[model samples]
Target: MTTALPSGLASAGLNAGEQELLDRVGQVARACAERADHYDRTARFPADDFDDLFAAGLNAPTVPREHGGLGLGPLSRDTLTLWLVTKELAKADLSLGRCWEGHANALVLVDALGSAEQKRRWFDGVVTRGEKWVGWSGEPQAPKPGEKRRFGTSVVRDDGAWVVTGTKVFATSATGAQWAILLVDTEGPGGARHAPDGRDSLLMLACDLSDPSVSVDDSWWDPIGMRATVSHLVRFDGTRLPDANVIGAPGAYLREGWQTAFIPHYAASFLGAAEAAYEYALKYVIRQDKVADPYVQHRVGSMAVDVESAYLWLRHVATLWDTGKREEARLAGSRARHVVEHLALRTVDNCVRVCGARSLIRPSPVERILRDLTFYVRHDNDDQVLATIGRALLGQEHDASFYKP
Candidate 1:
């Protein structure tokens, strides 16, 4: 079930080894595609998909180049390769792609800002032990009325360790993750202490999820789609983490700019799901002998345009990152995310319309893909993203090359 990527989508500067790696992932995608529905129905973690990825040597994309890893390029240095890998995984299963993306994102943070020992330990866990990682940054606001909305999670120093208390929601891949990268306020028991350097109080800590005080509440994650992601609520009840577990300095997570580079990873997943929907629609039409009908032809043709547009946006964003256009890449990525969001939604909607009601039935590939795309694309507010783009243009001048076509 491996589909050939359209000719225009080919990447440049890939070594023979990288190309072979991609080919191996194609086989893994097939295995994941076969098991996607069962996992979705049971709302279980796609452990098999991850096993396949690990066995194929894809579990650690940021291991230092000297250690035989893909390096930080997956985040910024090597975005095109990361884009292709993520898109391919998502083409088979968006939930799996999402979880893997989080794993890789955490690794990039370590690579960029972690101490040498931290990098050695975390990267070894992933590349050697086959450990899985997850990120949990969002927390539900405190429920007390008249309280300002803010992060409820906080960590404090205690006996040479950091004790964490509070709950994190949307803990993607929480079911079986061996490690977690948590965002917490460094304010101590006094309640509101700021960083000594006057930076943001928000800090990231890498902790073992096996800590006895840590627990995952799986009941809260029954959602409209992406059910297999198992992004449940995680609570840390005075969870003790070693002082050595602290990652980077306070605010380093945001200061490093990897977050902007990670935006296109989401865009890649969205485009992949849309591409899957498009493929299903094509097969449906061919099977029904309706490929010659004018209505079907028009719908397919329009979907082609949207898919192609998404491809171009991804390429531009990846190119911007590759060329070290950091500021331009940030802005382009912001706009590209929204652009791909709309294009993906339209592509799926049109696929469903063209395929008719039968495609909505169980076991139809389009059925699950439509649900996954619809749920996952709502990760951000389109209005807020657009406003950020507008404000950037209003406040600054840009070179003409930044906005060409």
Candidate 2:
């Protein structure tokens, strides 16, 4: 028998079209889960899984209908549906879900900030052609030994074209992505070498990853879990693009609050990973005839509670976004992220504890799930997120400003 969705998610607020999309996502997720082990074992990119997603019309749901997409507009009830889709996918395969989230984030930005021509180009390449898209924004390298550390990749205007030069670590799904929306600084050769306000000059560049100037370094991505994601280091050396390739104005990427709008997606993905571990433990315990033990029951009960709480928190964050409670939604997103992160970690731990040492061996789904969940929840700015929440709660600063990128 097919498992029933949680009560909270069974009746989640979704329109007819959104429900249809969720069903499609669920189908693809199940298929992805069936092959997740092989992909993990080989540490290879799940290209076939993405092909299944694309064939199911699940590649670019956030693009507007006018641009040939599912037209799930920003900050709408559809956002909740999208979160459900990501959660289901993550439950099946966290690495694929990570790549999907990046794709969704890219579409969100394109829909919000792209000009008419830019949107048409992106829609044709991604939505129509079924090409995969990813986002690369994280950077921790400096251009020179003495220069102040650069905050992001750099782009310089050169002879009517833009030359992007920098290296980005953790370029999730970089190996498979056909296009990337890169965060760049345009203030100077390498973005205001020592300026105090250089961070505010961030810009978004939509680059074709097939360009010769782009190179992928896969040597740095040997992780404990989510190994299939292939989030390697990527270098852009004199990667030239026309001025039209720039997606938004300088600082537009941050000013639009896109990051805050999509925070629930991340929470949903992590929650799904935890749920996967919990379900694995449930099945293992039942098969081993240990479900009747009081200790086993207690652990299972706690896992269920944690999973449900995380789902509810994700729903709350989605509701806040839908209701136009922008500031409150931002603050709530941060709080929910922290809560879900803790709950997910605990849920995985409980699952491992209940299942015992045998579950930690090879060919055991629980072991892999635990590793994936542990690595996935280590998102940046954990302590800073809590500090921001504290500041907002104490009225020391405006809540919305705390989530500015």
Candidate 3:
């Protein structure tokens, strides 16, 4: 039997086409949830979930319609509907949500920075073939105290072709992605360093994962949560590409406001995970005849508030972006993500607290939800996000924005 969303979720400002898409995504979410536990237990990639997505014609919603996509790309003005779709998908499986969001991020980069020819090539592959792409930016190492972080990957001009050599850690969907939109330092060996301002060194390149020089290292990615994401480390050893492969010039990746736009997507997905945990707790309480307890009732009420507040914050930020108030949108997105992160964490904890020990055991959906949501919310730079919001409200502009430029 199919489950229905809350009364207003599909009707809230969505056009008929969008509403239909949301209904279809609901079915996809159910399928994903059914298999989520099995994937988590075995620490295997959720290949079946993606296959289901492809069959549903839900693989490339962000691609342009002319290119066979729904054209709801990240840069599109329709932000609220997209968030709703992301939230539903995440509720079923946070791992797949993370992977799907990465694909959206890649599309945003391509739309903003890719050459026309590059877009035609990659976008057609995505819409026509259900090909998957992922974004890769995490480095394996960090700078020491009092030192700025530098890129570990490098792209250099060699014999009229670009030679890319570097390792990217936490590369989501590496095991299954056909392509990667990677961030690399354009400065070659013995070349000048990136500007201290942190804006001029990075270049975005499209790398074909099927290349002979690309390798996936699955040894380091066994995490406590979101294991089915297969976020393995990827190594590029002198991977060669033509000049046409460069998505954008050095510094173009950060300049397009993609990072700021991505905040809501993460928040929405984590919120969905929190919702899943809360719903499971609700069912368990009623099934066990504990719903009459005042304390249990209070806890559930509080969880409801958290989930609703997250949804509202996400909507506000999406609206702000859709209206083209980009700076305000960025500030709001950071603040909303911060608020939702805390709320999501609290909601999951409340779920466990209300259910007692059974919620912590294997085969219990709450336990898996807790682990996945916990790991997912640990995105870096929380303190910085807070400070950025604080500064914005105080009418003080920091030399740099909270996001990397």
Candidate with maximal lDDT: 3
Deviation (Å) of 347 in candidate 1: 0.7
58: Cα error in model 2, Å: 1.4
Residue 40 shift from truth in candidate 2, angstroms: 2.0
Q: What's the number of clashes in each of the models?
A: 2, 0, 0
**Model 2 global lDDT (CA atoms, 0 to 1):** 0.77
Where model 1 places Cα greater than 4 Å from the true spot, the runs are 1-8, 12-15, 72-76, 142-151, 187-199, 396-405
In model 2, which regions exceed 4 Å deviation? 1-10, 73-77, 141-152, 188-199, 397-405
lDDT of 1 by residue, 40-117 (tens): 999888998888778888878766776556664544467777777888889999998898888877787777778998
Clashing pairs in 2: none
Candidates ranked, most accurate by lDDT first: 3, 1, 2
Query: Candidate 3's error at 281, in angstroms?
Result: 1.4
Per-residue lDDT for 1-405 in model 2, tens only? Answer: 322336646346676777877788888888999899998887787899889988887777777777777766353346677777788888998888888888888888887788999888888777667888887776654454675534345677889887888777778888899999887776643322222232567767888999999999888678999898888878888999887988877766556556777666788888888888888888888889887799998988888889888888977877777777777787788888889988988888998899999888977777777888788877545676788787777877533422322
Return the clash pairs for model 3, or none.
none
